[model samples]
Target: MSRLWSPHIESMKREQIEEMQTELLKKQLNYVYHRAPFYQKLYKKSGVKPDDVKNINDLQKLPLTKTGDLQAEMKETGDEYSGRLCVPESELLAVYGPNQHPMPENPLITGITDSDRNTIIQHLARNLIMSGIYSGDTIQSLCWAWEPFNRVYMAANLLISPSVSEILGITPVTLEIIPLEAPRTFATARLLKPSLIIADIGHLTQLAAICQQNNISPEEIGYKTIILKEQRILSEKETKEVSEKWKAKVHNMLAVQDNMLYAEDCNIHNGLHIWEDAFIPEIVDEETGEKVGEGEAGKLAITNLFAKGNPMIRYLINITAKIEKTPCNCGRTHSRLKPQ
Candidate 1:
């Protein structure tokens, strides 16, 4: 089953994406400049105002913020994001964190307040739906190196609603190993021979080896959709070699737990298709803090419109990407993402 929005998003052209960004730029700027103190101070110092910023190009008037700014705020105020939270902490949802850097260094958390938790759950549920995953689809698991973590909880909750409560602390080993007799819990899905195998690329290679050594072809074992991260468990060169060696085109996806949602697909092998409606994204030189010209490589910065809990403007996401003015081969007007 093909995803409903994939075709539309993947085919979107460049002007369309920019047009969408222009439409939302004002609201996004306002959400941050007025509500976020950090942004307000920066805007004031730079002599930029949210109302004066009309289009995406006008964004250059604003100053760029780095992770150090956030660290500084946290060190001084003990709250990390002093100007970020437009709403009370009680209204926030879960914070997703500690992915880019080590757990000790870069940490992030989301606030779960009111129905936002339910909203996030439903949003992810829809995303899985868009990705062609569904209930009763046998799912083999990975990405669980740690217990009592958020990813495990999120995967389970997004896929299984009622029993999401039960998915906590489930061992990754237990999920990887098959049972001889009838298995209960998610074990049943595995025993039933799942339709999907969710593992990083390296794990997939290892699992393929294990199955082959055991004289099992993926077809014989009912292995169908294997979700491997497009980036890689091995080096990029090695991953490409494996793809050629196996004659497989491993699908790539953008899975941001917070700050962004996986609502769009990629075109032209850029990164994920960002929801320009959800965020106003800018690319700039990490060292120089100046805008990188279109198709030029730079760090990825984000200013989200709906983020009331943490109203960050020009928040440095530490990503390097290039802009494309050309339309994608797919066919729509949305600018596709390309991440390095």
Candidate 2:
């Protein structure tokens, strides 16, 4: 009867979570410092060794890495990975670049080993469960697609959808969003009667309009849940409006494409819970690069605890967000991020 995917890990006490994070952080720091060329140079320049970071509290001592730094390194060195890859090339499972318009020639690329990919799938599975997805529920993913291919689709197709299908035992029906094929996609949805819909705001809005043009009620589609892949936080009014429009519960998700980090809102709608076991989230002042006061709004920084390929430590994601340490109504003890 429990909805949690990993109750023991999800319901851990705050202290227990911190203890686990400390252990993982130390291991990750040592792994990256020695293997990842980027981390080695950065730490050497900062005059801080991996052993200097004794605990989570000492994370600020590590220098912050910007996306621009990775891009510049790639451009200058002509190495696709920009020296962030810690694992050997033969061990790589997948590589992804930033999903931007006019994709940069020397874009920042992220590679993952088989272990790294599995860890990402596990985090995504946790997000799906937190967003009300359950076993036996059919998910219809309406994400973007293009000629050269979008990295978001690659994540959804190769990682997200497959995680739901295989790990969670949920049926997945992913469709590439083509303007002319809207009716056919809806027809398939109607035939399948999927219980959950996963898409971004733009695709969902388009689907709503298409349903209207066809004189179809979204409620009649019978999907009771809508998981949105959104970067910015949605307002209460906007969430309510979307839920009303689709007659489904709306859950917002924050997914960073570079490192495949994910966070999702629980039914309580408080904030997106970051998987602390896999990642360490920090909010620091953009100008000072110092930790802000508790619950204070600042740029969001993330450190990958589970990544073995490209270990991102103290990487500022340029999003203004505050971290909430209080326990949630959903009973999960992981820290929540409230993006401004």
Candidate 3:
């Protein structure tokens, strides 16, 4: 089916997206500067006010937020929520601590307001549509690996599972394989005959290794599509190799623990289409903090448009990407990010 989860915004013109982002960015800055202490202090120190930022260009005036800022705030205040939370505990629907970089003493948890959580879920749904994943499709996803401590792929899958199943009515089959057990993974996939496979690059690589061991092609498993979620992009050679080996179409998606679904490739697979309604993406030089021209490579910066509890403004996501201002052949007007 040819459909967009949010047709109007997904098909918006480049100018329209920029205008919308400008409005959202202004509101977000004003909201966070007033409600979030960390942003308030940062903005004040940078001599930038909410009103000072009227458009995306004015974003250069605001200081970039680093992950260490949150940690430093937690260390000093002994309050995990002091820097990031805009609302009271009564208003928050969920609290999440970072799975990576564990600091037990001053562990900070981010509050997800009700609206924020819904935004995350809705964005994930949009990714499914953008990737050409449809309802009623059988999706085989990572469950638990043999090593219990390493559930990186499993955790990501679990996060989006509810939204996919509930909103799209898709059937999700999670595979839990014993450690060093390729046969088990192969068997599970064969039994399910999933049409779509959703997992991180590591898990998919492991499955590819299993395929070699058994002398069985991934195509024999019968999955038509594979979605590899990663913080970085795979090389074109690697992407082509995976598709050739598995006999399936491969799609890459960029996501982080902090932000759920940020960008995903359409069927054309040239670059990832930024979720324009949810995020305003910019490619910038990390040292100078200046916007890189279109088709230029630089660090990926994201501004969350609707996240109330934790507003991300000019936040450097610690990944490098090349921005493509040209429209995607798939008809999504959102800018494309080629993550490196």
Candidate 1: segments with Cα more than 4 A from true spot: 1-3, 6-17, 80-82, 100-102, 112-136, 140-190, 202-222, 229-249, 261-271
lDDT of 1 at 97: 50
lDDT: worst 10-residue window of model 2: 146-155
For every candidate in turn, the CA RMSD to the true structure comes to 6.2, 3.0, 4.0
lDDT of 3 by residue, 117-145 (tens): 66766666777777677767777765333
Q: Score residue 207 of candidate 1 by CA lDDT.
A: 57
lDDT of 1 at 187: 38
Whole-structure CA lDDT of model 1: 0.51
Worst 10 residues of 1 by lDDT: 177-186
Give all TM-scores, in the order shown. 0.70, 0.92, 0.87
Report the C-alpha lDDT of model 1 over 1-340, residue by residue, as the tens digit: 2343345543445566567777767776776666667777777887878888777787777777766766676666676444466667655544545444346442444443334344344433433443356555545554533421224334445443422223222222224322321123133433566655444555555555655666654345454444453321123464355456445433344444445444333223334445554566677877766788877778877765555566556667655775554554434334445644
Candidate 3, residue 113: lDDT: 67
| lDDT tens per residue, model 2, 57-90 | 9999998988888878878878889888887888
- Clash totals for all candidate models: 23, 0, 1
Q: In model 2, what lDDT does residue 133 have?
A: 79
lDDT of each model, Cα atoms only? 0.51, 0.79, 0.72
Alpha-carbon deviation at 246 in model 1, angstroms: 6.7
